[model samples]
Target: MDFTPGPQGQFPGAEAAPRSAPPNFIPEAPQMESRTFGAPGRPGVPVSPQFGFVRPGQIRRCIHRYTFIWLVNGNSFWFYPTFVGNQFVQGFRWRRNRWEFERINLRRILFFRCF
Candidate 1:
C-alpha cells in the first residue's frame, strides 16, 4: 500500500504507516559551523563602566575573544567571545591547556573589560 498521499491529500487508512515523516525527523543534519569574529577590536572596553553591564547588542558587536569577564560572584576570567545570543554570551575559555566552551548570562557579568 502506498503511504504517500495522492493529489486529494487524504490518508489511505489508519492501519498503514504515516504518510509523512515523524515530527522530530529532519531532512538534513545540522552542519557544524566555524565562525571568525574578525580582527580583534579595541580591547580594554569596560563592561560595566558606570552602573550597568553592557547589553547583548554591544557585546554582539565585539566578537573578538579578548574580553575580560567578571561574574557577579567575584570570579574573573578572560575568554574569547564566540557567539553572543539575546541573553547570554558563548565562548571558549582556556582551561587545562585546552579551549573549553563556556556560556555566561549577560546580566550576571559585574565587570567586563576587553584588554
Candidate 2:
C-alpha cells in the first residue's frame, strides 16, 4: 500500500509558483560614522580618567605556599589560598602598602561548597 502523494496531490496550487521577495528588504547599507564621546562636535560629558594600580615594575608577594595574590579595585590586593579539595582556611588583604589578615566566614564558604 503506497501512501505517497502524486504530482497533483501535494499543496494543490503551489507547484512551480513564483516566489515573492523576502518580507523585509534593504536597498543599501546604513551609514555609520565613528565618533568619540567627548569629541569636539559631540556632547562633552566629563569622563572619569581610567587608570590601573599595578605599575610596570610593581612587585607582588604571595605569603603562603598555596596562596595567590590578586589586585582588587586597582588599589588594594587580596591574597587567598587555592582550594584543593577542601574548605578555604585563611586569606589576607593588602591595603595602603600594608598586609592585613582576613578571616574567612565559614557559613558563606560552606554554602558555596555544598552547591
Candidate 3:
C-alpha cells in the first residue's frame, strides 16, 4: 500500500477511486475565554526588583555601552570619555568592575563624541 512517487511522476501503489468525507461535518467557532487582570493562574512575572526603585517616574535614563575590548573571552569593555578644556581624553577604563585611569587621546577619535 505504498504511494511513493516514481521517477516518471506516477504513484506506484495509489488507488484509482476517490475518497469521501464523514457524515457529521459540523464546524463551530473556537471556544475563547477572556482573561482578567491580576489572575493567579497567569504566567506573568515582575521584570525588575520592586524594592530598589519606588515609582516609574523615579527611573531616569538607561545606558547601554558596548566597547569591543577583548581581555580573556573576547568581550568589549566600556571606558568613559570626557572633554577636558579644548581637547577630549579617555577618563577611565571599567576593569574588574571598577574605574581605572588610562592615558588615551580622545582627539584622535573625532567620530566618537558623547555629550
Candidate 4:
C-alpha cells in the first residue's frame, strides 16, 4: 500500500494543490568574481575547493546540519544550532596554536565585541 498522502489528506478543507515550478525555473548565472579571499597565488587563499570545505577567511555550512563555520587566520569559529530565535547564541572557537576551544555567546560578542 502507498503511504503517500494525497492533497486532501495532507491539508483538509483545501482545494486542489497548486503545481510547483520547474526545478530549473531560475536560470543559472556565472559568478562574477571568486568567492575565495585574497588575490590569486596567495599563500593562505586558494581557488574554490570542493564543496563542504573551506579555507581561511572562508565560511561554509555543514552538509547535514544547520551549523555554520569559518576559519580566520589560525582560529576557527563555529555556530551551533540554537533555539533562541533566529540568532546563534551558542558556539565555540578553536585556537589552532593555543590548542584550546573557547565557548562563544553571540549576545556578548555583539554587545562587548569580545571576539
Candidate 5:
C-alpha cells in the first residue's frame, strides 16, 4: 500500500545516481516572455538598430525607469528591457520629473546643440 520508493525499488529510466544540484545554478521562476532584444553597452550611450518590440519613445521611458530602479533598490523588474509595466511607468515619471528640473538649467545648451 506504500507509494514511496525503497532502496531496492527500480524506477524505470531513472538515473542510477541521485541527482545533485549544480553548484552555480539557481532555479529561476517561470516567465511570460522567453526572450528579448535589448540595447547594448551603457545607458545614454545610444544604440543603433534599436532592439525590442516596443516603440523607441516608450523604450526610452522604460530604460529610464530601469536605471532608476537599479540606482534606488539595486534591483529591477526590467528582466527584459523592452517590456514595460505599471511599476516601471511610475518610476519613469518620478525620474522624468527630476530630469525636467535638470533640463531647465540646460535649455541654452539644448538650443545651441539643436541649432
Candidate 6:
C-alpha cells in the first residue's frame, strides 16, 4: 500500500492509501489428486505391498485373522488382530516363533490386507 501525505504532510490526513494487489497463489502452491492403493500419492498415503487382497474393513472382523500391514514409515508387518477401535487396533505381531501383543495407530498403517 502506498500512502500520500495530505495538506500538512500529516499521517491519515486527506487522501486514502492505495490498495495492495492480492497475492498470486497459483504458482506458489501446486494441486494434486489423492491416489488409491496401487496408484501414486503424497507422502502419508499408504501403499499396498502385494496383490490378491482387497481393502481392509473396520478392523473388528480381523480377530484371529492373519493380516499384512504396511506403515507410513516404510516398515511392514504381519499381525493378528485381537481388538479394533475407531483410530487404533490392538493385535499380535508375528515374529520368530511368537506373536507379540501390540497396540498400533491406524493412521500409521499405509495399507492393511486382511486374510
Candidate 4, residue 14: how far the Cα is off, in Å: 35
Q: What's the lDDT for all of these models?
A: 0.52, 0.27, 0.29, 0.27, 0.24, 0.52
| Candidate 2: tens digits of C-alpha lDDT, residues 41-95 | 2243222223112221211122132222222212222333221212223334334
When 2 and 6 are scored with lDDT, the better candidate is: 6
The parts of candidate 3 lying over 4 Å away from their true place are: 1-76, 85-88, 107-115
State the lDDT of candidate 1 residue by residue for 1-115, as single tens digits. Answer: 3446555553322122223222222122122234312212323334322323557777775475366666656676655676677767766654554555677778676555553
In model 5, residue pairs whose N, Cα or C atoms come closer than 3 Å (at least 3 residues apart or on different chains), thus clashing, are: none
Kindly report which residue pairs in candidate 4 clash with one another.
Answer: none
- Please give each candidate's TM-score: 0.51, 0.22, 0.25, 0.21, 0.17, 0.51
**Model 4 — which ten-residue stretch has the worst lDDT?**
106-115
Tens-digit lDDT string for candidate 6 (1-115): 2335456763231222213221222121112235343422333333333421222355556666676666657677677776565556766776554666577777666656566
lDDT per residue for candidate 4 within 9-108, as digits (tens), equals: 5321123211321122222221233564443234334333332122211221221122333332333233322112221232222233221223332322
Q: Which window of ten consecutive residues has the lowest lDDT sum in model 3?
A: 54-63
Which residue ranges in model 4 land beyond 4 Å of their true spot?
A: 1-44, 51-70, 81-115
Which ten residues in a row are the worst by lDDT in model 1?
Answer: 21-30
